[model samples]
Target: MRIGILGTGNMADALATHWARAGHQVVVGGRDLAKARRLADRIGHRTGAGDLRTAAEHAEVALLAVPFGAAAALAGTLRDALAGRTLIDCTNPVGPGFRLLTAHGPSAAEQVAAAAPEALVVKAFNLCHENVWRMDPPVFDGRPLAVPLCTDHPAALALASHLTRDLGCTPLAAGPLGNAALLEATAALFITLWVGQHADAQAVAPPLSHAAGPA
Candidate 1:
């Protein structure tokens, strides 16, 4: 996969490095060329670096790792470059109190899609910390990390699934793009439980078999 990462932040660093290590061609792009170059250097493995548009045009699959507040505008501006490409939206719209910033509006993924109407947008990778993504395989308790994806495009879903498996994680089809708000809201709740309440967010649910009461 030729992966373009549109940010120079922790999530970009964490996930891009893994894909690059897995033999995928990676280009890191940011508003600041120097930051993008620095991130590329850190990712190593002959990773590419450039300004945002350059990276956008170089990708078969693009990861929108930019801040949630800036993503829609950036996507709108890069609409032409992103057309026909599979766009993975990993941003969480959580405010200072771990609040769901989108509230009753469209989810962040939907906003990005609306901004870049021609892009095949997929919502994924927003459920975990950057450090968890940095893990070599992210397996825990004998189970591989399961990544839930929401996308209306089949090709976009496949691309996202491939990337998830590249990190040795399972990709689950959560639903189409319409359900993205649910995923974003879930992220907010999990963050609140994990950080604000200092609780194990994973413990909030029972295993699959026990989800609807005893079998």
Candidate 2:
């Protein structure tokens, strides 16, 4: 797979590193060419560095690792280049107090889709911190982390699922793009519990066997 990462941040580094190590062609792009080059060097497998336009134009899948505030605008600019592409949105719109910044509007993923109408926008990788993703295989309590993705496009979802597996994680279909806000909200709540309360957010949900209703 040819993957384009549109950021020089932690998420971009962590995710791109995994993909590159998994034998995917990765292009790390950012506003600062030097930063992109540095990240590509750090990942150094089948990875390269380029301008944002070059990355988007050449990728089969594009990961929007930019900040939530900037993602929509960036997508708008890359609309043509991203057309008919699988665009993964890993952004969380959590603000101060761990509130969902997009509480009243469309989800960050939805906004990106609207901005790039021809792209297949998939919401994923927003629940955990970049450090968690940095973990080789991200397993805990003997279970690989399950990533819930929301996307209308089956092909995009399949591609995202394959990328998730590349990191040794599981991919769960969480519904269409319209349900992305729910995922974003879950991230906000989990982040609040993890950061503000020093709680293990994973412990909040019981295992499936225990979650079943009395029969």
Candidate 3:
């Protein structure tokens, strides 16, 4: 797959590196050409680099790895270029105090979909830190990381699932885009617990076998 990354940030670097290493064609684009070039070069594997529109137009699957504030605007700007494409959103709208910034409105994923109405938008990969994504396989004590994706489009979910597997993680169908706010809100709560409270956010939930208790 030809993967275009819409940001030259940590998420872009981490995910794109894995994809490129997994034999996917990756083109990284950012507002700054030089930064994009540098990242693309670092990702190597003949990765391409250009401005944001170049990336969007060059992809069958585009990763919207931009900051939460910039995602909707960029998607809106590239609406025509993104038509018939699959867009994977990995951004979290957690603002200061670990607040879900889109609490009163649509979730960030929905906003992107509204911006690029013709594109297949999927919300995924927002739960983990970029550092965790950089962990090569992100398995813990033998269990590979599970990436939950929310999207109504089948093609978009397939692409997101493929990418998740490329990182040696499992893909979980997490319902449609309407449920994205739940994922976003969960991120906020986890962030608050993990960073602010210096607690183990993962420890808050029991394993699947214990979810219903005394399994």
Candidate 4:
């Protein structure tokens, strides 16, 4: 798969490295070409670093790893490049203070869909912490972590599922794109807990194992 990620941050580097290790072609882009290239060098992926449009154009699957605040402008830059392509929106709309910026009414992924009508947008990978994206995941009490996903497009969902599996994570289909609100809101809930505990806010959510439920 040709994966184009629109960020040079940890998420973009992590995913690009994993996919590249799994033998997929990966490219990462950002506003700073030098930063993107630095990340690519570290990840050792066959990557091309450039502006948003360049990355979007080179990918069959374009991932928006950008912060939600920049969603609108990034969407505009990626407009023509994203037509009929599967776009994975991994952003959460949190404010400068890490407060919820978007209402519970809709999710960042939905906003992306609205912004890019021609693209097939899917929401996934917003639940896990960047730490989980970094090192090889250790088993937590003998169970693997479940990564939730939501998308209206079956084909897009399948591709995401395969990619997640390749990264050694379980993919949970939490229904269509509309359900993305729950996923985004869940992140907010966890962040609140972190704030309350005075815990390290630098981390993302740790991978979670499913609890036993009523049979």
Can you give the TM-score per candidate against the true fold?
A: 0.98, 0.98, 0.97, 0.87
**Which model is ahead, 1 or 4, in terms of lDDT?**
1
TM-score for candidate 1, residues paired by index? 0.98
lDDT of 1 by residue, 73-103 (tens): 9999999999999999999999998989999
RMSD after CA superposition, every candidate: 0.8, 0.8, 1.0, 3.8
Which candidate tops lDDT?
1
| Global lDDT of model 1 | 0.96
Task: List, residue by residue over 78-184, the lDDT tens digit for candidate 3.
Answer: 99999999999989999988888999999999999999999999999999999999998999999999988999999889988999999999999999999999999
Candidate 3: which pairs clash? none
Q: TM-score of model 4 relative to the true fold?
A: 0.87
Tens-place lDDT digits, model 4, residues 66-164: 878787568766788998888998888866565777774567888888888888888888866677776565245666677888999888888889888
Worst 10 residues of 3 by lDDT: 206-215
Ranking by TM-score: 1, 2, 3, 4
Candidate 4 residue 8 Cα shift, in angstroms, is 0.7
Candidates 2 and 4: which is better by TM-score? 2
